[model samples]
Structure formats: structure tokens, C-alpha cells
Target: MEKQIAIIGGGIVGATAAYYLSTLPGGQQVKVTLFDDGLGQATTAAAGIISPWLSKRRNQQWYQLAKAGADLYPQLIHDAQLGTDVYQQTGTIVTREIPTDLELLFDLAQERRQTAVTMGSVTTLTAAEVQAKIPLLANAQPGVFISGGARVDGAALVAGLLAQATAKNLTIRRERVHLTAQGQVVTSLGARQFDRVIVAAGAWAKELLAPLGITADVRPQKGQLIELAVKDYPIQENMPVLMPEGERDFVPFGHGKLIVGATHEDDGKFNLQVDPTVTADLFASAQRLMPSLTTANITGTRVGTRAYTSDFAPFFGPVPDHEAILVASGLGSSGLTTGPQVGRLLAGSALYGGTPDWSEYEKPLATYLKPSAE
Candidate 1:
């Protein structure tokens, strides 16, 4: 009999795990089922920036995880057969409003090259030169460019993965899951037994794991973004993503769509309403980065409640006591970069047990994520 694997989420983590597990050695004898509530999830609202070098986070583990996330995009796109609609390598521009900031970014560029990170051509660009390639950029601020930066349409990618997984014998159930008993998960299709159940439900994970007494404490760090119709400005197509050091960032969505985001609102609610103040501030910020954005119209707004972890690292491994209930949550804002990597790790843990034991990390992660036990 084949091993039955039930994944309770259709977000990036669950979707990627379903796809990867089905392709592993001896995977032909496995049956995988993915459950989703059908509401579009957080990955859909991601800023989709794949530039790790631009981050100011100096923690060794954080840097390595983020870099790994960026480094895996190209191969992930190819392996998943995701087209350019879902993944595009338009590169990124990290700008600096001051000389010190510019020097720091330039120095990081050198560090990336020394560490064998192929950031295409890490070169400093004058405001005028940068504006020529991206006329919207503020011509007063200098920036360094990474020729290898890219963006992913998080929604498109997840949809594509789910579709592909469905085509490859993976079952998709649109319903909330219930853990009625040990070694079992109940969905809309009724109760069923599974060899292993993975809860990669993002922000909703801890509640789902309550039956097993695991505190996931996945905080929904809300990221609100404004998508503008920028084709009205006749800007260069495929202009690299731009972010002034320590300011709000913007990514150019293909077909004249540019995205500016994201406010880290940890208010702990499903507030999808685009706050007028936040939205206004994002627009003003974008306008400062790209002068032409002043003429752009607000085509739409997106709100993705990122699963912010205490340490900013996702929880990926089996629950300590209940080994069958694995988790891959709290991915925060880098789901696009870390999706494939998370999938691989969880798949290994679920299948052959070769993945790193995250026992020590799980308690710390849960303490940060879970509510008080009063």
C-alpha cells in the first residue's frame, strides 16, 4: 500500500512540498492530498523581491537562509515549469540617499562577489544612469545594481504549482481541516487516515495544531501594497526593482504594473482593508523612488498577512511528541525565496527522516508564536 500524506494548506509551503514529494525517489508509491480553504493566501500578496544582498540583516543564519531563498529561484522556476508570468529575472537596484548608505551597499556588493554569489554585475550607478534604465527613480540618489535580482508572481506561482500537482495525481480539497483524533485528519471529504499530516497553513497553523497541543503562534505580519498602472508613464519595460536603503521598496510587475509596499502591521487581525494612511504613505514613498509614479493611478491594492516568526526563520520539522504532524510555517515575507527550500526540507523529514532535527528550534519558535497559556 502507498503511504498516504495529507498536507493541510495550499500556500507556497504546502504547494511546493506536494510537488517535490511526488517527484522524489520511490515517490511513485506515495499518495499526496492538499487542502485549502479557497481564499487566496499570503503568497498572493507578497512583494516578490528576490534580492537578498539588499537586506540589512547581518545575522549569519538569517543571511544564509535568505540567500538560499534567492539562490534557488532560477532552478525552482525551471523545475516547476513556471513561465515568466510567474517568475521574472529583471534584476534589482538598491539605492542610497546618502554617501554612507551608498558605500555600504557597494561594500556588500563586493562581499557577494567574494562569497561567489553571482549577482550578474554589481556596479554603482549614477542617478542619471539609473534613471535612464528606470526613469521613475529619483535622479538625485545613487544606487548599486544587482544584475541577478528577480521577482516572482507569488499568486501565479502557487496557482501553477497547485495546478501541476493536481495534474500529477495529487488530490486538492477545498475545505477547512479538522484533527479529530491521532493519526487522522478530517476535511470536507469526511474523515480519513493518513500516514503523515503536515500543517503548512501559514498564519492559521497554530489553531489547527491545537488539538495536538502545539503552539505555532504564527503572527500575521500584515503587508499592505499598492499596485499602480505605470504604463501610463512610458517607463522602460523590465526596469529593475528599486528600494532606497532603509525605505519602502518597489517591484516592477510586468505589463506596466509596479508594486510599492509594505507596512509591517502586527495588529493581529485579518484586516484586509487598505488603510488610507498606509496606502497614501506607500504611494508617496513610491513617488519619491520613481518620479513618474506621481502620474500613475492606483489600479489596485493587496494585503498579505505574512507569517512573522519570532526569529524570522520558519518552523520546518515534525512536532516533538506527535512526529506525524509536521510544520512549515512562519515564513514571514520571503515565501517566494524560501518556498522550494522549505518544501525540500519538509519532504525529506516526512519521507526518509534525513532532514535536520529542529527540536531545539521548535520550542523557541513556538514560544514566540503562541499566545500565553493563561
Candidate 2:
């Protein structure tokens, strides 16, 4: 019989998993089913901004995954028939008023052998230098670090992945999943047996796993962002600029708008309402970082909840007692950059014994699974 795999969650992680599993060596004989309650509203809220360099400091594992995902975009776009304009390779700029601790950042990049360089002494940049790089960043502080990175339209990326999965004949079930013993899963739409099950439900993973005696300490970290529509703004390119204050990140989408985000709030609730205070704080930071955006009109604003683990690294690999189940959650803020690689890793683990230990890409499987009380 063909091996059956049930993937819970249709976000980037689940969709990418389905896509990769469908293309594996023996994947033609393998059957993949994806389950999700919501389409792209929950954790895949089209708010992801993909900048490889800025996300490098998170960890070596994440950096590798992000870099690998960056490499996968070209083929993914081609396979999905997604428009090339969906991905903007405008690069990213990391700016700081004074040089912050580049030691850890540099060490990480060096360990990964990443393409990073310290431009001269960490002195302030001239207005002309800033304009030459970011064109949008005017009246900025002295020091800045520029690196090669790309910005992906996350909404379009997810849509394209979904379309590709459908074209590949992967079954998608639009329903909630209820886990049974021994890693069996039942969905509202129907029930199917699988050789393995993967829980990529993001923030909701813990809820589904709780009934199965597995506990996931994943929490929802709320990130609120504002979109501004400024047609004539000089920052026409799609690059991310880090603010000097609190290390805020501002990404300009190529389509006459900029996304200023992100507040990490651990309220333990999934609140999607964009807070005015958060928006004001983000705008203030953006104006300080990119002065030209001060005149940009606010087009829209939104709040997204991301999944985070206790250790803040992702939870991957198989459940301890129930070997039939695997998890790929707790991506936090690097969902877009790391989602594809994570999916591939999980799929490989399912097919093979487990994910290969590629330097920092240690699968933290122990955190999600526990032995049943005797």
C-alpha cells in the first residue's frame, strides 16, 4: 500500500511540506493530505516580510533555513507559475545610530559563512550614502550595514504554494483535526489513516496535541504592522531597513506601500485587532529611521499572532512516545523565510529516519513530546 501522510495546517509550513513530499523520490506513490480550519487568515496572514540578513541573528539553524528557503524561491516560483514580480530582490539595510554589538552578529554570520561585511569603522553614514543605498532613508543616523537579501510578497507566496499543491493533486481538507491514539487524526470533513502525521498547526498545535497527552509550550506572540501607500516616496524599492531604536524593521513592498512592524507582545491571546498605540510606535520608529515616509498615507493596518516556543527555536521531528506523529511549529517571526526548509526537513524526517543534523539545524523534538504516565 502507498504510504499515507496527513499534514495538519495549510499554512506555509503545511503547504510546503505537501509540495516537497509530493516531489520526493518515492513521493509519487505516497499520498499526502493537508488539513486546516482557516485558509490563510490565522497565522499565514500575508504579513510576512522575507529579509534573509535581518533574520540571520536569530540563530544559525534559522539562518541556514532562511538561506535555503531563499535558494528555493526561484524553482518554487517557476513550478507554481507565480509571477516573478511576487519576489523583490531589493536587498536589506541594517542601520543603527551607534554600532550595536556586532560581535554576536558577525560571529553568527562567520560561523554560517554568510555573505556579510563590516563597512569600515561603524561610524555614521552621510545623508548621501544613506540615499545611495536605501533612497528612501533620508536624514538617517550615522552607521548602517547593507547586505544582499530579498523581500517576498508573503500573501502571494502562500497563494502560489496553495495553487501548486492543488495542481500536484495533494488533497486539502478544510476542517479542524482531532487527534486519536497512536497518532491517528480525525477531521471534520472526513477521516483518513496515515503512516505518519505532522502537526504544523502553528499556535494551535498545543491545543490539538493536548488531547493526545502531548504538550506544546508554544505561545502566540502578537506582531502588529501598518501599511502605508506612498506613490511618490523615494523608497520605491522592496528592501528592509532596521531602525536604530529597538531594532524595528521596516520593509517597503514594491507596490507603492511600506510595512512597518512588529511589536512582540506575550498576551497569551490571539488578538487580531491592530492597536493604535502599537501603530503609533511603529510609525514613530519608521519616521526616525526613514524620514521620507513621514508623509506617507496609512493604507491599512493589521495584527498577526505568531507561534513561539519556550526556547524560541522551532519544534520539529517525531513525537517521543508516539513515533507516528511529527511536529513543525514555533517558527515565531521567521515563518516566511524558514517555512519551506522546515517543511522539507519534516518531510525528509518522515520518509527517512529523522532530519539530518546540518550544523545548527538541530531538531528540538524533545520539547513537544513526553512519555505517557504509567
For each candidate, the alpha-carbon lDDT, in order, equals 0.74, 0.67
The regions of model 2 sitting more than 4 angstroms off are 39-43, 46-67, 70-75, 78-81, 99-125, 143-147, 232-235, 238-247, 290-296, 351-359, 372-374
Per-candidate TM-score against the hidden true structure: 0.90, 0.83
lDDT of model 2 at residue 259? 71
Deviation of model 1 at 153, angstroms: 0.8
Question: Where does candidate 1 stray beyond 4 Å?
Answer: 138-140, 181-183, 232-237, 291-296, 354-374
Taking the tens digit of each residue's C-alpha lDDT, what string does model 2 give over 214-307? 7776877777777887554555764444444364666666657777776777882578777778788878877775556653477777666688
lDDT for position 136 in model 1: 58
User: What lDDT does candidate 2 reach at residue 334?
Assistant: 76
Candidate 1 residue-wise lDDT, 1-374, digit = tens? 88889898887888888877777786777889888885537887765778877677655555566677677778778987889778777778887778787888799788876763646778888888777777655544688988888877778888888787777758988888878637479866677888888888888876677776556656777778888877534544477877666668777776777778767888835677778888888888877765666534788888866776766766677776677778878777777777677776787677775447544323334444343352
**What's the distance in Å from true for residue 141, model 2?**
2.7
143 Cα displacement, candidate 1 (Å): 0.8
Best by lDDT: 1
